[model samples]
Target: MARRRPVRAPEPLRATSMWRVDQVFLTRRGVRVEVTCSMVNDQGGLRNLSVTAPTDDPVQAVRHAARFIAGRGNVSSARQARVRWAREQTTTLQDELIRDRQLEDEFLDEFEETLSAVRDQQR
Candidate 1:
């Protein structure tokens, strides 16, 4: 058997992968949760990235996900909360509008009746 010399690996272009996470954020969507990462691209510009951890640890992923969750600002829990409030407001406003319409109709009906009564009295 001949002894082979070990070949050295080439230097990596960057210290970390472009998808590497500088921070993480945990986001909840309804009962489910997802992880997001904050990373600098090749250009070194700040960006929110959707990615996965090498070990697939939710806790570690959440740490990077925190960056995505906060920076991306699309958390489902908060969105659902806002949506619930909006729906409630819409329902209340709709009810009020219907009530106002009913009141207006009654007022018009009464006004016509009063005018008719005045005409009868004149006769």
Candidate 2:
């Protein structure tokens, strides 16, 4: 009689290219990545940020963190740097939101002024 080899288990689930993506959450391996990006206007109104990434890539995990920050909140950065900055900025953003009075309004005003200056330079 011959001995049989052990069977391999199925691979864990991950985000696939076929996923129906939302602007808010991207989940994989039971890890939920919630995105909250925004742009602060000169009028003190916070606007959402846009996040983009390839779903099927293993690198998407890294992008997920950045997406979570840039998706619906006022986080800024691009590519890998975005992911790195997102981690620290996200936490600071939360703390600012919690304790600081009128933090959102202040951010909006500052952002708007900065944006206006950039646009002016671009013209």
> Which is the leading candidate under lDDT?
1
Point out the worst 10-residue segment of candidate 1 by lDDT.
77-86
Compose the digit string of candidate 2's lDDT tens values, residues 1-123. 999999999857644212111222222332433333333433344445444433533244334544344332233323111112233334565543332223233333443455455556659
* lDDT at 55, model 2: 52
lDDT for each residue of candidate 1 in 32-122, tens digit (9 for 90 to 100): 4444444454456675545443434434434343333333322211111110111222346664333223322332343345445555665
* lDDT per model vs. reference: 0.38, 0.36
Judge candidate 1 at residue 55 and give its lDDT.
37
Estimate TM-scores for all models: 0.26, 0.24
Q: Model 1 segments beyond 4 Å from truth?
A: 1-19, 51-123
The clash count for each model shown is 12, 10
lDDT of 2: 0.36
lDDT of 1: 0.38
